[model samples]
Structure formats: structure tokens, C-alpha cells
Target: MPTKVKPPPAVTFAHPSEAEIARLLDFYGVRWEYEPRQFPLEWAEDGRPTKHFTPDFYLPDFDLYIEITTLKSSLANRKNRKLRRLRELYPDIQIKLLNARDVEALFTKYGRRGEEMNATKAEK
Candidate 1:
């Protein structure tokens, strides 16, 4: 069966949660461009048809690609395959995977609104 692929959203890096990671970048005066919108398939030598992979963040300045996965989706074969393909295609490209707990912890530790907000929401 032929699967359909959706176009990447018109999202920018500014949307990343203003937690420790982001704050740390800011504190260190590091600048990065996120989701520049180049097709992953372009990196493939054979030009075979493959599912498009949209990672969480693309740090152009550092030449790194980040993929953040939750607990459920992290374990999926699809994720593993994508990781493998990325590794095969671009061995030098840095790939980062973050779990949900890390994200929440980031939110709790350095979230602009503070972890108390998260706690209140979780209670509900």
C-alpha cells in the first residue's frame, strides 16, 4: 500500500519550550536555526522512496538534528528504522532523542512558568 506523507508544518525553533535546554542556549549566547525544510531523501544516494522524517529540532549552526520521542512512540520499529536510516545516510549528522520524562523534567527545572504549573496540570 502506498502511504501518504504530509508536508512539514511551517514551524520554527522559537516554539521549543523555554526550558533549561533553550535557556542554556540563550545563556551561552548560542544561536540555531530550526526545521529549515530540506527533504531527508535528498541525502540518499540511491534516491529510493522512503518515509520522510521530521525531527524535533535542527541546529544548523552546530550541524545537529534532534528527535524527541515520547515513551510510547520511542519504542516503535518505525522510530528504530528512521534512526537507522539517518545513521546510514548521514553518519556525521548528530541525532538527539529525548524521552517524555526528560522533557517534563526540563519543564520542571527551568520552565519559564515553573514546575508548579506542571504539577497543578498533572493533578487534574
Candidate 2:
């Protein structure tokens, strides 16, 4: 009897930029996880987490978390604050934030248009 093969699970990215990043990582043979962990940034009076920040990719080989943001300036500023708070709370945690311009450059280098960076959200 032949054994049944299970298909790999599908990954859904919050933004097109994330998918591009995944492709780049795959091209380089780097192992990565998408939104694997969330770090609590704020706690309420009752001790529950009020806010959390989840990075886009976690590279196990490099022990690093990367966040790619192509949002507008206002939204990017919020992300910056969250990153700052996360670093303050977890100084040992390694993280890198790729801003809009950085992401654009990456896309350009890889032959992807800047507009495609955030063209749509939640793409499979």
C-alpha cells in the first residue's frame, strides 16, 4: 500500500513586503519563522499584557528577529516606539527593524517595485 503524503501548511503574510522577505530568505537558504513570538510591551494594573509586538521574521540560525515595515510615517513611528519599548524590556533579545526606505531598497535590489511593498495586506 502506498503511504499518503501530507501537504505543507500555507503561510499567510500580513503584507506583501513580508512575502518578499520570505522569498529572499529562502533564496539564501536561510531558515525563518513568521511571527513566531510576541513580546509583551506593556502590562495593565491587573498584570495582564496591554500591548505586544510581534516581529515579522525570526531567523533561528542567526538568533535574530526582523521586522519589516512599509507603512506611512505615522504608523512607522508607532512601530519605532514599540521596538524601543521591547528593547528596553528585553535587552538581550536581538531585533532589527527595516523601515520603509530600507524595505524599498531591498525590493529594488531584488527587482520588486516599491509600490508592491505594501500594495496589499494578508496575502497568502
Candidate 3:
């Protein structure tokens, strides 16, 4: 029987192929919390429970929350509703969203840049 090999941890978003928006946060030195689960407690006009939404990362340093979406469909309406509700629930909190393409582009560009910088240093 062959032993399975797990891939090494990646420093580049490209390695995981998810575009890794975390790199952007790291680049900006923003402290972040990932996969935070939040339940809705507010009620509708008729006093029905609100919907639950989970944002991707929470930046404590910036006092902002972020969501990264890779779905093909534009979930703008759903995202907006969640943000609005979240604001009403937590007045001081801010939410930021980044789409898949945006994150992927950043990863490709920055990952290449990092590689190039390393090669240059190696040559020197």
C-alpha cells in the first residue's frame, strides 16, 4: 500500500487555487479572524427570527468584517441584506466583500511578484 502524501502549506494563493484573499489581508498587515459563525437574533416586523449569515474573515484591527465569494452567480442582493442586518445588529461594525476574480487576480500578480523578487535576490 502506498502512503498518501499531503501537500505542503502554501505561501502563495495560487498553490491552493482558491485565489487566497488572506494574502491581501496579510499584505496589509490586517489582523483577521476566519470562519466566524454568527446567528441572527433580530426579529422581522411580525417578530419572526432573522436569517443567519457567516462572513469569511473578521479584522479586529480594522474593526471590519469581510466576505469572499467564489460562486458564479452574483449574490449581491443576499450579501447586501446580510450586511444591512448586521449593521442594524452591530451598528459600529463594517463589512467588506471581495469577489472571486478580484482575489484571484491579486494572488496571481502578487505571487508572481514574490517569486520574481526571490529570484532577483538569489541572483545577487
Candidate 4:
């Protein structure tokens, strides 16, 4: 009998920025889960979840969730509101929101300006 080798899991990232962040985490050997959990922000009268907030990445080692937004400040308001609601509902959870400027700075620090530009273009 021959042994079989399993292929690596395939993950589809919603944005290029998320892929970049995953690469960074892999490079540093930090374990991460992409969009692994969704927290309910709003519920219907019947107890059904009407709105949810799913953070982009979860660093299990650090027990932290990260949400990345490359949108303009004005466009990010909805996400901001969702984050606030998530924080209020789940005060024990640790989550961080990285805005456009923060992500740009990260890309610049990692010499990935081209990828950052691509992400910006995709956002628009």
C-alpha cells in the first residue's frame, strides 16, 4: 500500500490586503486563522442574527482578532460602527481594527508598496 500525501488547505481571501497579512504572519511563524469566526452584532426579534462582524484574521497565539479596512475614512463608518457594537457585546474579546493608513505603513515597512498600491486599486 502506498501512503498518500494531503495537499495544503486552500484559503480564499476577500482582499489582497488579507493575503498580504497572512503572508506576513506565515513569514514570522505566527499561527493565524482567516475569517474564522463571526460575531453577531444585531439580532431580529425572533433571535435570528441580522448582522454580523467577521474580523479578517485571528492570531490564536496572541488571542487577538484583526479587522483590516482599506476604505476611505468616510466609507469605513459602517465597519467602525460594527466594531463598536462587537466591542460592546463582547467586552472580553480582543479585536483590533487596522485602517488604511496603518496598513499602508505596514506595507511600507515590509517593502511591499507595490502590493499596497494593488490593494488600494482593488478597493476603488
Q: Candidate 2, after superposition: displacement of residue 59 in Å?
A: 0.4
Q: Residue 59's C-alpha lDDT in candidate 2? A: 98
RMSD of each: 11.7, 5.8, 8.0, 6.4
| Best-fitting candidate, scored by TM-score | 4
lDDT of 3 at 32: 69
List candidate 4 stretches off by more than 4 Å. Answer: 1-7, 112-124
Candidate 3 regions exceeding 4 Å error are: 1-19, 37-50, 108-124
Q: Evaluate candidate 1 by giving its C-alpha RMSD to the native, one decimal.
A: 11.7
Residue-wise lDDT of candidate 2 within 67-100, one digit each (tens)? 9886688888999999999999999999999976
Once fitted onto the true fold, the runs of candidate 1 whose alpha carbons sit more than 4 angstroms away are 1-30, 37-48, 74-76, 111-124
Per-candidate TM-score against the hidden true structure: 0.53, 0.80, 0.55, 0.81
**Which is the better candidate, 2 or 3, if ranked by TM-score?**
2
Note the Cα lDDT for every prediction shown. 0.60, 0.84, 0.64, 0.85
How does candidate 1 fare on TM-score? 0.53
lDDT by residue for model 1 over 1-124, one digit each (tens)?
9999996455434334534354445444566445544437433557765556766666777878766665776465566677788778778778776666777775567553434554555686
What number of backbone clashes does candidate 2 have, counting pairs of residues 3 or more apart or in separate chains? 0
Better of 1 and 4 by TM-score: 4
Q: What residue runs in model 2 are displaced by over 4 Å at the alpha carbon?
A: 1-7, 110-124
